[model samples]
Target: MLLQETAGSDETLSLMQLDLDDFKPVNDTLGHPAGDKLLQFAARRIQDCLTSDDRAYRLAGDEFTVISRGSGHPAKAHRLAEALVAAFKKPFTIDGIAVFVGTSIGISTAPPDGTNPEQLMKASDLALYAAKQDGRGRAKAFDAAMLELLEQRELLRRSLRMALDQQQFFVEYQPLAEGSRIVGFEALLRWHHPLLGKIPPAAFIPMAEADGMMPDIGAWVLEQACREAMKWPENYIVAVNVSAAEFLTSGLTDRISQTLDLVGLPPERLELEITESVLLERTVNNIDTLNTLNVLGIRISLDDFGTEYSSLSYLKTFPFDTIKIDKYFITDLETDPKSQTIVRCVVNLAHGLDMQVTAEGVETPAQAEWLHSVGCDRLQGYLVSRPLPVEAIGEFIDRAETSVSHALV
Candidate 1:
């Protein structure tokens, strides 16, 4: 009705949609009562930023919408969004406990972006999604480009649902080497869309996770990888990456154990790799899950280590068998003194914890040699071999072993 009233006049109105970032962890950790209190405090902060001409509404959980009416709407909307984001920078004290959260905002202007509520809301929602995708805690204005991207994403999502059934998905194995000898292979998921050609995991994996498809997809990958590993040398382990959703899913350990038994692969021959996100919740259930997997004799590795803020603390908490240094630090090892120092420190830290360290993206022999000098337990990257299909693994392993023997000679 407000939008309808504004449409008849010469007034320009802007709608801003705001979402709280990292809000779930607070709710999960502190409980719903604290989350409600935090939301109230957040609302007060947002209200303090608004003028008499603007009104705020709580759209849903951790989501707020503001309607602004004025001459300079875009500027006003931008300023309002910026203010809300800045306001969240300060911690909200709940029960004397300081809790921090950030906000991402999307802005859509009336008379330009849309005139009706539905169109305007859709526009703002799309903009908000873009804000989150571009590393949240920022604001984005709706544009035609966002609409196109949305269409592409929707198409991909629908296609992804049918990908497994259509046999468009496969697993690739990248070799993990200790010095010149290959000790294991990391299982990487690959998708080949019939119409879109090859889709990168970075592009589709998150989408699948969000759509609740990872558990099913992850199960298939585990079975397929284990089946293939059965053909490899008994000593060569196959490492499979596990998403946070899959890691936290109930009966994950049982599913994995079933896959191994079904494929006739020993539990010790498999390694499950997970990132720090899985440990962010620090739930007792998560710890219990890890403990259960450990009891099953499956090697659990911390993948892409040293990327998150609480990496050191996670190392202290979790019983990770191996820590894989992120590729970002290893990429500059040859040129940057800081990278060298950080990598060496991480290697030492992992060793001190009785956990091995694997350097990712070791693309050059110099990096490999330096990593080995620091007692890095493993190396994996393009220098050894690119991720190969199941058909190519046998030949590649044969050639790799032959090359290692010649080097030793």
Candidate 2:
């Protein structure tokens, strides 16, 4: 309508796409009613910042679009976008609670960026995506480079989808040790592309999750880890990391039970590691899923503990068998007194709850010594050993056993 009305004028049309940052956490923390109220308040704030000639639309959940005719240039559109962002700098007062969120805006102008609604919206959407990628709460104008990055990410997504079927994925076991005695191995996933050679899990794991491939990949990991554990000492347990996507989408409990049964691996000998993100949903269904998995004698470890928001709440909410102090705290333990205190406190906290603690990323013997002194039940990282392929695990274990024997003698 703005384009039609201003067809004959020397006017420029600018479309701005806006996305609210971390909006789901509000709904998850406060009830959906509060989230709804916050969204309404946020929309009014955006609408209030616009002129009579400009209009705003709630295109979708926590996303809005501003259409401005006669905006003159990209600079003018940017100023309007900045004004909308500034409006969100304050918290939304919902039910007497001050809740916070920020906005990311993507601007696309007509004639230069696009001419029609479809083209303009796409450009603006891509710009919005770029703004979010650039850490949110900012404005990014439509640019050619953003499109290239998006294309590259799409290529990665495609490659990751076929990694499993192509037999390009494998699992490596990192020995989790306690004073030279190998208690178990933490299963890590590795991928080697025919053309790319080796792709780090850090680079592709999120892409796999985004593409909804984690369930299949996670199942394969569980089955493979179980089968491999059958080769280890009877008392040793194998730990496999599970993502939130896999936990929620897959029949994880049934799959674990069945995989253990098929491999003839005892349930007590398998551990499933979950990150704090898995507990964010907090729905009854997710809680039930965790409970069911726990009932099956599968040990559940809260992986990457002390890394995310509300670590203690997760411990209280779910029945976790172990907690892994994040590597950052371990890195700071030597130089920072606060890190030492935090580590000691976590060790005590876990032990108080009858849960074991694992100190991750212990590089120096000093760090290991301090952790062992503080009663950390397990140690994992380079100081212990890097993740090794299945063929190499036996040798690693044998070497560690010999070293322990020498020390004892």
Q: Which is the leading candidate under lDDT? A: 1
Worst 10 residues of 2 by lDDT: 400-409
Query: Which stretches of model 2 miss by more than 4 angstroms?
Result: 1-10, 47-54, 68-72, 76-90, 337-341, 401-409
Against the reference, the lDDT scores of all candidates come to 0.89, 0.85
Q: Please provide, for model 1 over 270-386, each residue's C-alpha lDDT reduced to its tens digit, 9 standing for 90 to 100.
A: 999999788866468888888888899999999988775444767777778999999999998999999999999989988999999888887877787788788999889888878
All candidates: TM-score:
0.89, 0.86
How many clashing pairs in candidate 2? Answer: 0
lDDT of 2 by residue, 180-207 (tens): 6878899999999888788888779988
Best candidate per TM-score, number? Answer: 1
Model 1 C-alpha lDDT versus the unseen true structure? 0.89
